[model samples]
Target: MVITVVYGVLAVICLGYFAGIVIYTQTVGFALFWLLTGLLLCAAGAYCAYRRKHPDRLEMPLMLKSAVFTCVSVGFLILAAAGITIFMDTEEEAPEDLDYLIVLGSKTVGREPSDTLKLRLDAALEYLQENKKTRVILSGGKGSGEDWTEAQVMYLYLKNAGVQTHRMVMETQSTDTEENVIYSLNLVKKTDTVGIVTNDFHLCRAQALARKQGKTEVYGIPAKSNWFLLPNQTVRECFALLIEKFMGNI
Candidate 1:
């Protein structure tokens, strides 16, 4: 009965997390939801293994094994669900008509943009080239170390890539994803309809965050990433989605 109640509580938490992800559509919320779910499953599995090993405590070895398998199976299923979501979310489709292109930030080592950030910038640049009339907003702030802010680095990169300075705006005060949209919104005029650009695994959350910040017409432009790193990134996103849901940030 104790084990059953514990499992029930864990199941409830997992269900809440799942609902939060689908409803809030926040990456951090999904992340946190899965994080908690994973931890619970792992804990349950360990407890069952312990009970199985202690034959004097529990008379039914078969029951303990079944419980362990169930816990592990549920955990694996949750991870698989998150993986499938990431894969399905990866494709980038250009919006029909966009007034603004919002390029999200990534890490910088000194003055150079990280590979992830570069991919996002490349995708955004491609979008700009295809739609020459849209204004670009390079959004991100500086972290510890290094030279220029993410926004400045992106601006310089875009400038060097032949985009005109007049066509670009910069929002350099945002330190995180939530702040990225919040701060960027200040730079947007009332007439602008924004499309956010980020990596494929990142788009769902970014779009959700943008919508939360009142950018109703936001679209996602996702950049590509290698397959091996995809799993870790998806897992990270799931945790992030959960946190955002809890905080009501998205």
Candidate 2:
């Protein structure tokens, strides 16, 4: 009875969360994951209830049940551990003095920076305004529906924010975070103290990749993430961190 109640409640909460994201962000791919898992849990709960009400209908081996339970338990534990690691890096302060700032790219609508990109740009602008000596490396490639490369968009945005052209460098060939680190780091010398500018939820993986790419002294200048998208993105970041680890990308 307790198990049924827990599963049923989780399923409802999951579905409600999914609806919340879709309604708020109009985004789909990232939001589908938790919703699907919740529905699966709902099915599982239904099966458990059926087994209880109609014991003779189907008999499950105790070992199979134990295995399923163990897998779910272990999965939650792993996610919790990853969440902890991610949260520890979320509010990292950008060092007062820095040689280089890496403003990582995000989606752009036509030539305009997307909301996420805007937050990064704003954060980078604030940092640059305060740290006059810091040079910036704008990283990202052109994606569909984008009128210009991500680097180009960031370059213009920063330029408009009063960042001098000479203080900024553009690395336009990279399309992903690993490439962002690889290509951007090349533009800056090894001795430079690098700081990555991105949303707070993304700092952990971004720093990890920077470290993996041999920039061990790199730091994160985390920008504010949109509150409406925060829950889904935070959860997504856990899976992303795990994958990056498995692939040795970070």
Candidate 3:
């Protein structure tokens, strides 16, 4: 009965989180994770309720139970370790006087920067102001429904904010983070001290990708993320890290 109640409460919490995300952002993204987890929790809750009524009936064999337990334990450990890797670099900052700074792009609101992209641009702007010699590569391609490529939007924002055109270059062909690093690196040497500017939760994976691409002096210039969205973004990043590892990109 207690176990059933626990699962029931957890299901409601997860489902509530899913609903809140849907209402707030309108984009599913990683919030689908909450939806699926909520449904699974609901099913688990139902099973717990059924088990409570059945008592001794439908008992599992000890060997199979042990196998399931082991798998679950191992999976939990892997996820925990991945989460730690992401969190540890959330507050990372790049050293000054980098040879190049790659500003990874996020979504755009028409021709303007979205909040996520704005944060990244703002962080990069601050760094550029301090490190005048650090050239920037604004990296992102156009996506569906976007009025302009993300790199173009970033370029406009930074240019209007007083960053000189000569100090920035646009890599408007690369669509994702891996490509962001790849195509941007083509504009400069791999031996250059490059700093990747992105949201705080994304720095770890971004830096890993840079290293995987043979960049020996890569650094992270983390931007702040919305506190309310951090949990969802962090989980999505954890899965992304795993995927990148599986694909041998990091």
Candidate 4:
């Protein structure tokens, strides 16, 4: 009875932690993590119940118990399949050519680009350098902590990097990714084909949203995130994908 009670308590804690991850994180990776942890707790609860019914079976020895645990662990393999499905369904492929390059915004630390934002900016610069004829649109709004809008910061960054001001369009009123596409699209001519630049994990949703907003020819140019940040970011993106799917927002 004591063992059962202990396992029950631990199981509840594990479930609560999983719930917290879902509520706080936006990525698909968190969902996969919680799903695996929940399955483990469930298995532990089942094991406790089974032991209670056959206490004398303990004589079967530790080796047999280890084997049972190993077999039970295979359930997590299903989670991998689910994760892959979620990821693949959201990914948007890039087109061979584009007329406009749209750069999405990341968080700014007081008017300056944060490291993550810098990576995005740098990627956009590289793309612009490669495609000299493409017009660039920088989209972002001024948040509470920002000294200036994200578009303004990006404009300055690109200009300092030697991109001519005439080739850049600044959309400075969008506060989120969806808004970024919507607001920036207004600035693009109807005949133009757009290429969106954002973090690699975000490309899938960003492209989907852009298409929904009436972009006939859209492409994605993905920027890589740092290794340590990937887990959290991926988890957040999974949730974003799910929400977009549920609401038909993508």
Candidate 5:
């Protein structure tokens, strides 16, 4: 009964988080993960209730139990590895006087930066202010329902923030992280010491993607994430890291 109640509470929390994310972000994205997890928790709770009423109603075959255990074990291991990787570089600092700093783009609202993207931009702005010689590549294409290319939005934000036009280079054609690295790298030599700016939860994957594309001196400059969204975003990044590994992207 205790375990059953715990599962019920967990299910409600997950489902409520999912609904809150949808309402706040106006997009589903990986909030589906929360929805699915909530449903599975509910099912598990139901099973526990049934087992309480029928203690010996059914027993699983040993072989089938072994298979299920193996699957669960493997899944847990994968998720753990991905979570570790997602967080490994969250506190990294880029070496000074980098040849280029790549600001990977996220969503923008109309002509303004999204909260996530603004964090990246602010981080980049701070770094660029201190390291005036480093040019920045604002990388991202127009995503669905956005008012302009993400790169363009970033460009205008930094410009108004006092970063000169010559200091900003726009790679406005890449739609995702891999493409962000690929297209941004094309604007400079692979041997260049580059820094990638992104939210803290995304630093590892962004740095890994740069290294995968033959960058030898790349590093990360992590921006703070929105506290309320950090858990959801980090869990989503773990899945993304696994997929990127499966697709040979990082």
Candidate 6:
């Protein structure tokens, strides 16, 4: 009876979790994975409830139970580790004197910048307004769905926002973070100090990648992450960080 009640409660929680992730996030991989796992939990709960009513039925095999427990424990550990990385922050507060600022790109819809990209640009704009001597590098290639290259869009947006054309350098050939750093570095002198401007959730890995590329004197300039998309983005970044770790990119 106790096991049945516990499973029933878990089923409710799992279903609720699925609804929240699917409806709120609308993110592809994360939402779908959560929803499917939730449905499986719901089914398992239903089976448990049925078995409680018929105690003669066999329980879940011990090996399967152990596997489930192990998977859950490992998942929790990974999540906890990723959560700790959020606070392993670098020098996020914009400095008054930077020789170069590399503003990383986000997705662009048609010709308009995504909200994520806009926030990074807004941060750069503020820094540029205060530090006129700092040259800017807008880094991103044209993604498949984008109408314009992210770098071009950022360059044009900042130009209209009062940053001088000569102060901006567009790096449109690189498609990923490694290339973003590598190509942007090529445009500047090795002796030059750089400020990495990216979303707050991305700062830890971005700085790690910079250091991997031998950029020793880099400062992180974090932009505000979108509140609605924060959960999805942070979860996705955790997976990305894992890949970067395995690839030895960070």
RMSD of each: 9.2, 2.0, 1.9, 8.2, 1.7, 3.0
**TM-scores of all candidate predictions against the true structure:** 0.70, 0.90, 0.92, 0.67, 0.93, 0.86
Q: Tens digit of lDDT per residue, candidate 5, span 10-118?
A: 9999999999999988889889999998999999899889989998976567898899779989998988888887878578667788999999999999999999999
Please give the lDDT score for candidate 5.
0.91
How well is each residue in 143-183 modelled by candidate 2, as lDDT tens digits? 76678999998988888889999999999999888888889
lDDT at position 113, candidate 1: 83
TM-score of 6: 0.86
Q: Candidate 6, residues 126-147: lDDT per residue as tens digits?
A: 9999998999999999987788
Better candidate by TM-score, 1 or 5: 5
Clashing pairs in 4: 26-236, 27-235, 27-236, 27-237, 27-238, 28-235, 28-238, 29-235
Off by over 4 Å in 6: 1-30
Candidate 1 local lDDT, 1-250, one digit each (tens)? 4664566577666656655554542235334545576567656656666665774784557888799789879877876765566557456566755888888898786777877788999988888888988989999998766489999999999999999999999998999888888888788876688888888888877888888877777778888764534554677777677667778887
Q: Which stretches of candidate 1 lie above 4 Å from their native place?
A: 1-72, 89-92
What TM-score quantifies how close candidate 1 is to the native fold? 0.70
Residue 170's lDDT within candidate 4 is 91
TM-score of structure candidate 4: 0.67
Residue 84 in model 5: lDDT: 83
Pairs of residues clashing in candidate 6: none
What C-alpha lDDT do the candidate models reach, one value each? Answer: 0.77, 0.88, 0.89, 0.77, 0.91, 0.83
lDDT per residue as tens, model 4, 1-250: 7767777777776577666655653334345665676677677777778878987664557798899777767644543443464456334545544788899998777667876788888988887887778889999999766898999999988999999999999998999888998989998888888889888777778888988987857877877775655655666676677677779988
Q: Per model, how many backbone clashes are there?
A: 18, 0, 0, 8, 0, 0
